[model samples]
Structure formats: C-alpha cells, structure tokens
Target: MKLSISRYNPELDSRPYMQDYEIALVPGDHMLLDVMLRLKQQDSTLSFRKSCREGVCGSDAMSINGRNGLACITPVRTLHGTVVLRPLPSFPIIRDLVVDMTNFFQQYHSIKPWLENPEPPPEKERLQSPAERERLNGAYECILCGCCSSQCPSYWWNPDKFVGPAGLLQAYRFIVDSRDKATDERLENLRGPYRLFRCRTIMNCAEVCPKGLEPSHAIEKTRMRMLHVEASGELDTHTPPAGRPSITN
Candidate 1:
C-alpha cells in the first residue's frame, strides 16, 4: 500500500515535507500503527509517538486522511488509497507526526482538572448516589489525547486563551461531580470572552474524539450552567442591555 507520511527535521530540513513509502501489508498489520511500525523499520529516522498501542495512552494520535485520530485504533482496512498521515493540525510541529503540546497542556492545566472540596474530608472516599454519579458519564472518559482540542478552530486561533474542548470537558467533569465543592469557583475561572465562550460549537471536537466523547456538548452544558449562575445573581456580573444578546450566547 502507498503511504504518505509527513517528515521534518530541524537540524537538516528547513520545513516539513511528505515522504512516500510502499510497504507490503503483513498478516499482523491490522491497524494504522502497525503500518507505522513497519515503516519505522524501513526508515529509522521516521519520528512518531506510540505507547500502550491500545488507545488508552493516547500517544499515537495524528492526522490520518485529514482527520485527527489515534493510529492504534484506526483499522487499516478502513482506509482507502494513498493513506496520508501528519502531525495534529494547527500545532507547532516538533518533528514528523509529533507536535509541541505545551500550549494544549497549559490550557488544560488552567481548568484545575482535579476535584476541589475544602469541606471536611470523609472518613472514607467521598461517596455519591448512583444518580449523582451518573452525571459524570460522558465527561469522565476523556483521555487527554489532544485530538479534540487540536481539531477545534477556536483553540487553533486562541491556543493560550481558550480552554478548548478537552479542557472544558475535564472542567465539566469536576463541575458536575457530586463530591466537588468548588463548582462556582470553577465556572468563575472560565468567565471570559475567550476562555470558554470562544467555542463556536462546530462539533469538530465531537467528530474526532477517539473515545466517542462529545466535547461540544460539554461546552454547551458549561455555558448553560454559567447562564444559570448569572441569572441567579450568584456571580458578580451584569445583565445584558435590552434587545442585545448576551456574550454568553
């Protein structure tokens, strides 16, 4: 099969380029990552990231056929012809199929991903009712692969300011947790023109998530919760002018 993989070396080449390869598909070559491994044998210089190879580590995420996905889970048989692979889009390329994830991680860290409860700790782990726990269903499955956030155009434009989908999904994860006590503070932190409101709900984040999570939905839920707080006067904010749509919209 013909494969076009992006190649780059700061020490040698000035810019990125695609290098084609023709490899014989072997018996164990079931996923895209398998082909990548075979190609690696042919050219040791080819650079990429892979670990766990089970879609859990989320290390092998890249742009396959113009869509961001984890190579470990993408079936080779599902690809058509001349499979094209590249680093995640709109990210600074560190090398072939590898990107600088510093900005992505910075936005993620800004959300305060862990649970916050200043109240007295429980003797055991904090327990939640079954229904309360169920609120975290879709938000808890994010693997921080950078697939959703990298594909988001808002993040592409405002990588530093926007929390992006993955971070927002993580933020909502703690916000809806029954055991968390800092939901208001978490929402307040996201209060700004760019941080959370920049999401256009384009659904690209939902489309490329390897874990089938809906980050756009999570972003919408966050927006709704913010609006609820604003309406209740719980947050120090002003009402929108008459006949003018609120920025939260």
Candidate 2:
C-alpha cells in the first residue's frame, strides 16, 4: 500500500509538502495509524501524534482521503487507492502531520468545561438522577479530537471568537447537568454573537465526529436556552462589564 503523507517542518521548509511511502500490508494490519507506524519505522523523522491506539484518545485525528477522522479507527483496507494524509485543517502545523493544538485547547478552556458549583459539597459526590444523566449522553462523549472543529467553516473563519463545536458541545454538557450551579453564568458568557450564534447548522461537525456525537444538536439546545433566557427578560442583567474582552464573529 502507498501512503502520501503531508510533510512539514517550520524550521526547515517554508511550506508543507507530501512524501510517499510504500508499506507491505500484512494480514493483521488494518488501521491507518498502524500503517503510519510502519512508515515511521523506516523514516524515524516522520512526526505525528497517537495515544491509546484506540479511537478514544482522539490524538491521531487527521485528514484521511480528504476526510477528517481518527486514524486509529480508520481501516486502511477501506481506502481504495493511494491514501493521502494531512494534518487537521486550519491549525498551525508543528511538523509532519502534527498541528499545534494550543488554540484548540484555549477555546475549550474559555468555556470552563468543568462543572461549576459554588455551593457547599455534599457528604458524598454530587450525583445526578438517571434521567438527568441521559441528557449528557451525546454531548459528553466528545473526545476533543480536532476533527469536527477543524472541519467547521465557521470555526475556520472565526477561530479566535467562535468556540467551535467541541467547545459548544461541552458547554451544552455542563449547561444541562442538573448538579451544575453555573448554568446562568455559562449562558451569560456565551451570549455574544460569535460565541454561540456562529453555528450555521451546516452539520459538518456531526458528519465528521468520529464518536458519532451530534454537536449540532447540542449547539441547537444551547441556542434554545439562549432564546429562552432572552424571552424571560433575563439577558439584560448579566451584561459583561465595560472593557471586558468581546468574542465577536
């Protein structure tokens, strides 16, 4: 099998290029990541990220045959011809097939993905009823692999302002958690034009998610919550202070 992988080194090359490698496919070899590992064995300088070899880690996400997905889960045999591999689009390339994820994580952090509750802790851990827990099923499964967000046109245009599908999915995750005490505050922080409204419902996020999670659905739920807040006359009170950073589209 032949793999044409994108190669880039900011220190050495001004732009990215492709390099081809031929690997002898064995009976047990199936996944694209396995093929990459075989290629790396021949050229030790080839760089990429992988962890857990399973798709759970989401670290091996890249453009495979012009689609965004986790290489760890993609079967190499499913690809008909020469395979083309590239880093996740719209991110700073660190090296061959490795994109810098600093901005991706920053957007995640901006949403405060953790549960926020200022109330005193209970004797036991905070627990949710089964029905409440079910609300998080789709939203909580996100592995934070760059696939969905990298494929999003809105995020590509407003990378700095829009939190993107992964962040918004997590935002919905916390927003719907019955135990979280900061639902209102979370909604307040995301009230800006780009923060929550930039999602055009293009469905690219849901289409490329390796986990089959529907980030667009979660985004819609968040939008409904914002509308509910507005209709209830609750939006005026939580206006951010003057000179506060505004995330606009």
Candidate 3:
C-alpha cells in the first residue's frame, strides 16, 4: 500500500513537504502506526506522533485520506485510493502530524469538569439507581479524543470562549447526574455568550468522533436546559444576544 505523509522539522525547515511511502502491507498487518514506523525506519527525518498503538490514548489523530482519524486505529486494508495524510486542519502545527493541544485542553478545563459540591459529602460515596446513571451515559463514555473539539468550528475561532466537545460532555455528565445538585450554577456559568454562542452546530465534531459519540447532542441538550432555566424566570437572563440561534431540533 502507498501512503503520502507530510514531513517537517521546525528547527531546520522553512516549509512542509509531502513524501510518498510504498509499504508492504498484508491484509491484517497494515496499521497506520506500522506504516509510519516503516517510513521512519527508511528516513529518520520523517516524523509523526503516536502513543498507545491502540486507539484509547488519542495521540495519533491526523487527517487520513482527507478525513480526521486516529492513525493507531486506521487499518491499512480499509483504505481506498492513495492515502493522504495531513495535519488536523485549523490548528497550529507543531511538526508533521502533530498540532498544539494547549488550546484544546484550555477550553476543556474552563468548564470545571470535576465534581463540585457546595453540599457536604455523605459518609460514603453517593449512590444512585441504574436508571439514574443512564442519564449521563452519552457524556461519560468520552475519552477526550480531541477529534470532536478539533473538528468543531467553535474551537477554530475562540476556543477559549467555547467549551468544546470534551468539556461539554463533561458538563453533561454532571448536569444529568441525579446525585449532582449544582445544575443551575453550571447552567448559569454556561449561559453567558462565551459558553453558549461559541458552538456553531456545524456537526463537524460529531462527524469525526471515533467513538461514534455525539458531542453536538450534548451541547444541544445544554442549550435547551439553559433555555428552560431562563424561561422559568429564575436567572433573569436576557434574550440571547443577537447572532445566537438554536441549531438543535
């Protein structure tokens, strides 16, 4: 199989370039990371980032054949036509296939993902019924893959203003949890322009998600929940300042 890869070295290079690699790939032996390793063996100058060969670590995501994908998870046998590898779009490229994740994590942390209880804890861990746990199911499965956030148009503009997919899912995880009692405060924090308006609902995040997770849906639920909170006449939040439109059905 043949794969075209992007190569760059910031300390020694002015611009990036493409290098084609023709590797021997058996039906089951072809993995994206394997192909990259082969290319590096032939030319040490070739560079890419990879961490767990499995998909969980989310370290090897790149544009595979023009689609955002995890190199570790992409099987060589699944590819059609010439494979084109590029850096994830709309990010500052660090080198070859790696991009700066500082902004991504920054947005993630702004949402205050960890459990925050104004109320004191019980004598032991809080317990809930199975039905209650299911409410936050969609958000709890996220592995912070960055595919959703990177593909998000909101993150492309002011990543700081918008809590991207990872953050939104984390927010959803707690928002729906029956044991958590701070939904209103969290909604209040997210009601402001930077929190709600940033998501453009382009669905790019949902499209590229490796786990088939719908981070957009989580964002939509947050929007609706916030609206309901406002409509109850509690926060006295004003009408959504212009330019913010509800994109969910």
Candidate 4:
C-alpha cells in the first residue's frame, strides 16, 4: 500500500510537504491507525496524534483521501488506492499530522460546558427525561474531533473570534439541556458579532463530522432564537462585542 503523508518542520521548512511510504497489507490487518502505528514503529520520528485506538479519544482525527474521519475507525481497504493522509485542512500545524487544538479548546470554553446552577442538585444522580436529553441530538452527538471546525471557513479566516462548529454545538448542547438554567445568559453571550451571526449555514461542519453531528442545524436554530429574542424587544442592555465580524448570506 502507498500512503501519502503531510510533513512539516518549523526548524527547517517554512511550509509543509507530502512524503510517501509503502507497506504490505493483509486482509483485516490494516486499519488506517494501524498503518500509521506501523510507520511510527519503523520510523519513530514520524509524527501523528492518537489515543484510545478503539475510537473514543478523538485524538487520531485527520483527513484521509480528502475526507475527515477518526483514523482508528477508518480501514485501509476502504481507500481505492494511494491513500492520502493529511493533517486537517485548517488549524496551525504543530508538526506532521498534529494540529494545535488550543484554539478549539478556547472556543469550547466560550460556551462553558460545565453545568452551573443557582441551586445545588439533590444528593442523588440527577435524572433527565429521555425525551429532554435527546432534544438536541445534533449537539449531544459532537465528539470534539475538530473536523467540523477545521473544515469551517469561518474558523479558517478568523481563528480568534469565530466559535466554530464544535463550540457552537456545545453551546447549543447546554442551551437546550433540561437541567441547565442559563439559556438566556448563553443567548446573551451569543448576541455579539462573533456569536451566532458569524455562522453562514455553510454545512461544512456537518459534512465532515465523523459522528454525523449536524452543527449547522444547531447554529441555525440558535440564530433564529437570537433573532426572535431581539425582535421581542426583550434583549438585554449591553454593548456589542468589539472586533466581532458580521455574518452575511
């Protein structure tokens, strides 16, 4: 099998390059992650990020044959020929196939994933109705693989402010959770330019999600909610965020 891999070295090259590796494979013997591990074993210097080879860690996230996926979950036989593995299209490449996730985390923090409350939960497992828990199917399914954000144009242009797909989905996650009580505050934070307005409904985030999460739909729902709140003349009095970009059709 022929594998094309992306290469980068800050000390030597200004940009990245593609390097090829050839390997022999047997049936049921070569998953993409397994192939990558083989390469690493052969040449320890070869770089890539991976954890939980079973696919839950979301660490081995990369683009294979122009499609974003969990490397561990993708099989070698699935590719027609000459498999091309690249670091995600966007995000600052840390090295070879590893891209820095600092920005993704920052955006995620903007949404505040932790459950906050004015009153403490009763000393028992907080229960949720199955219907309520599934209210935001799109948001609940996000695995934080960064594929959605990496493929997003908004993130490509403005990594600093645009919350990107994963973050927005996380926000939507809490905004609709039955136990969450800060929906209005969450909506207020999204009132800024970098918030809901930045999404173009490009659907790129949904297209590349490995878990089939539809972040685009979540963003759209949030946009409509924000607009309705504003139209109701019930919007809170606060200055619009500075340096926030506008979202246009």
Candidate 5:
C-alpha cells in the first residue's frame, strides 16, 4: 500500500509538500493510523497525533483523501489506491499533519461547555429524568474533532467571529440540559451578527462529522431558540447574569 502524506517543518520548509511511502500490508492491518505508525517507525521525523488509537479521542483527525475523518477508525482497505493525507482545512498547520487547535478550543470555551446551575447545590448529584437526559444523546457524543468546524464554510470565512458547528453543538448540549439554569444567557451570548447567524445550513458540517452527530441540527435548534427568545421580547433587555464570565475570543 502507498500513503501520500502532507509534510511541513517550520524550521526548514516554508510551505507544505506531499511525500509518498510504500508499506507492506497484512490482513490484520486495517486502520489508517496503524499505517501511519508503521510509517513513523521507518522515519522517526514523521509527525502526527493519535491517542486511544480509537475514534473516541479525536486527536487523529485529518483530511484523508480530501475528506475529514479520524485516521484511527478509517480502514485502509476501503481506500481505492494511494491514500492522500492532509491536516484539517482552515486551520494553521503546526507541522506535518498537525494543525494548531488554539482557535478551535477557544471557540469551544466561549460557549461554556460546562453546565451552569445557579440554584443551591444539592447534597447528591443533580438528577435528570431519563427522558430529559435523552435530549443530549447526539450532542453529547461530539469528541471536539475539528472535522465539522473545518468543513464549515462560515467558519472558514469567519474563524474569529463565527462559533462554528462544533461549538454550537456543544452550546446546544448545555442549553438543553434539564438542570442548567443559564439557558437564557446561553441563547443571549449566541445572538450576535456573526456567531449563530453565519451558518448557511450548508450541511457540510453534518456530512463530515465522524461521530454521525448532526451539528447542523443543533445549530438549527439554537437558531430556533434565538427566535423564541426574540419573540418573547427578551433580547431588548437581556443581560448575562452576574458571576457569568465573559469570553473574549
């Protein structure tokens, strides 16, 4: 089997280039990450990211044959010929097949991924009914992989202003939580010119998600929540409650 991987070294190469390598494949060898590890064994300079060696951790996400996916779960046999590898699109490359994720994490953090409860703490864990918990089924499965966000055109164009699909999906995760007390504030935060409105419903984010989660759906739900808030005349006087931290980027 042959693998053509994108390579870049800030210390040497001024631009990225593709390098090809030949590998012997066996019946047991399937995942693309395995092939990458084997290639690394031959050349220690080759660099990429992988953890858990499974899809659970999205560290191995890259553009495989021009499509974004986790290398750990992609079967090599499924690829027709030489597999082409590149870093996630619309992100600054740190090195070979590894892109800087600072902006991605910052957008995620801006949405406040954690639950926000203002009520007094209960003695035990905050309990949610089975039906209430089911609302988070798809949204909670996201692994923070850059696939969806990188595929989003709005994010590509406005990486700084737009929150993108992954962040919106997580925003929905906290907004719909039955125990969360900051639903209004969460909706208020996203009600901006470039934040939630930038989504054009292209569905690219949903198509490229490795987790099969529909971030587009989550984004739509968020838009609907925004509409509801607007219809209720809440935005005119909406303010983030005290103690809620502000996110700059």
Candidate 6:
C-alpha cells in the first residue's frame, strides 16, 4: 500500500509536510486504521488518535483522499492509488493527523447538550409517548467526530461565531425532547444571526458524517420551530405507555 500522510512537529519544523511510505498489506489488514498501526511500527514519530477500533469512538477521523471519514471504518480495499491522509480541514494542527478540537468543543458546550426541564418531576418519572420518543432518532446519533463541521464552508469562515453543524444537531436533540421545558430558551440562544443562520445548507455535514446523521435537516427543523412554523412544546399528544423509568429523570 502507498500512503502519503501529513507530518508536523512544532518544535522541530516550522511547517507541515507530506511524508510518503510504502508497506505491504497483510491478509488481516481490513481498515485504514490497520494500515496506520502497521506504519506506526516502522516510524515511532507518527501521531494520530484511535480508540475502540469500531466506528463509535469518532477519535480516528481524518481527511482520506480529500474526503473526511473515520479511519476505523474506512475499508482499505476501497482506496485507490496513493492514499492521502491529512488532519481535519481548517482546524489547527496539533501534530501529524491530530488537530486541536478546543474551539470545536467550546462551540458544542455552548449549545448545552443535556436536557433542561424546569417543571416539577412526576412522583415516579417523566414519561414520553412512543411517538414523542421517535423525534430523537436522527438527531441523537451524532458522534462528535468533527468531520461534518470541518467540511463545512460556513464553519470554516465563522468558526468562532457560528455554532457548527455538530453543535446545532445536538441543540436540536434537546429542543425536540418532550420532557424538556427549556425549548424557548434554547431557541432564543440560537436566534443570533451567526450562531444558527450562518449555515448555507451546503449539505457537506450530511455528506461527511460517518453515522449517516443529517445535521442540515436538524438545523432546518430548528429554524422552522423558531419561525413558529412548527410547534416547539412538550408534544404530549398520546398517552404514555408502561415503560421503565428514565435514568435521566
């Protein structure tokens, strides 16, 4: 396999450069992460993040052949020619394939990802109908991989002021929750011109997401709810079914 990976060392080199390597792929080599580990054995200085070799960790996200994806799940067999690996685009490079995600996380934290319900809790637990629970399906699967935001042109321009796709997706997750009573506050917080409206609906976020989640759709739903086109309340239309109490209650 031929690999061209980005290499950077702030203390030693002033600029980053692409370093090439050729290695034989063994029969066990299935994913890009496997090739990376084999390369690391030859060069101890190579740096990248990987955890839970499955796709859930979101730690191994990088640009593969100009497309952002997770190394843990990208099949090596699908790669053609010299595979190019680079850090997430537009992010500050910490090292080779590792980019500083401080700003990314700060934006994520700004949205308040946790549920907010100021109403008095029921004697046993807060409950939701099956239909109400279904609202969370597409928005709740975000893995915070930074792939979507990194590929977004809007995020690249206003990373500081704009809440990126990943953050807005999480914002919608809580905004649609039936038990959450802070829908008004959440919408108000995102009412800023740059924070929510900066998104150009480029659909880059949906294209790069490893989990197949659509942050663009979630953002549009949030915009509609803010405009009063959709109801933003504790949608308790159906009777609650007998179920286990929520641990978050």
TM-score to true structure, per model: 0.95, 0.93, 0.91, 0.90, 0.93, 0.90
Residues 1-249, candidate 4: write the lDDT tens digits: 888898997888799999989987756555789878877887787889988887677898998998788989887778778888899887789899889999889989988886767777789966789999779676776778899899988788887888998999998888888888887889888777765667767788899888888898888777767766777867855554554334443
Find the candidate with the highest lDDT and give its number.
Answer: 1
Total backbone collisions for each predicted model:
0, 0, 0, 0, 0, 0
In terms of TM-score, the best-performing candidate is 1
User: Which regions of candidate 1 fall more than 4 Å away from where they truly are?
Assistant: 239-249
Q: Judging by lDDT, tell me the better candidate of 5 and 6.
A: 6
Q: Is candidate 1 or candidate 6 better by lDDT?
A: 1
Badly placed stretches (over 4 Å) of model 2 are 237-249
Among all windows of 10 consecutive residues in model 6, the one with the lowest summed lDDT is 240-249
Q: Model 2: per-residue lDDT, tens digit, 75-132?
A: 8769878899999999889999889889889999999999889889999999888999
Compared with the true structure, the alpha-carbon lDDT of candidate 3 equals 0.79
Q: Tell me how far candidate 4 lies from the true structure as C-alpha RMSD in angstroms.
A: 3.2
Which lDDT values do the candidates have, in the order given? 0.90, 0.88, 0.79, 0.82, 0.89, 0.89
lDDT of 1: 0.90
Q: What CA RMSD would you report for each candidate? A: 2.4, 4.4, 1.9, 3.2, 5.8, 8.8
lDDT by residue (tens digit), candidate 3, 1-249: 777888777997798888787877655566878877877888787767788888888888888887788988888779877789988877678988888888787767777777777687889988889999879777877777677877777777877688877788788888888887788888887876767667777888889988788888888888888888788987777768567776557
Candidate 6 per-residue lDDT over residues 72-131, each given as its tens digit: 999998999999999999999999999999999999999998989777888998899999
- Specify the poorest-scoring 10-residue window by lDDT in model 3: 23-32
lDDT at residue 200 of model 5 (Cα atoms): 81
Model 2 per-residue lDDT at 89: 92
Against the true structure, candidate 3 reaches a TM-score of 0.91
Alpha-carbon runs more than 4 Å astray in model 4: 28-30, 237-249
Name model 5 segments beyond 4 Å from true. 237-249
- Give the clash count for model 6: 0
Q: Residue by residue across 122-182, what tens digits does model 1's lDDT show?
A: 7888999999999999999888999998899989898988899999999999999999999
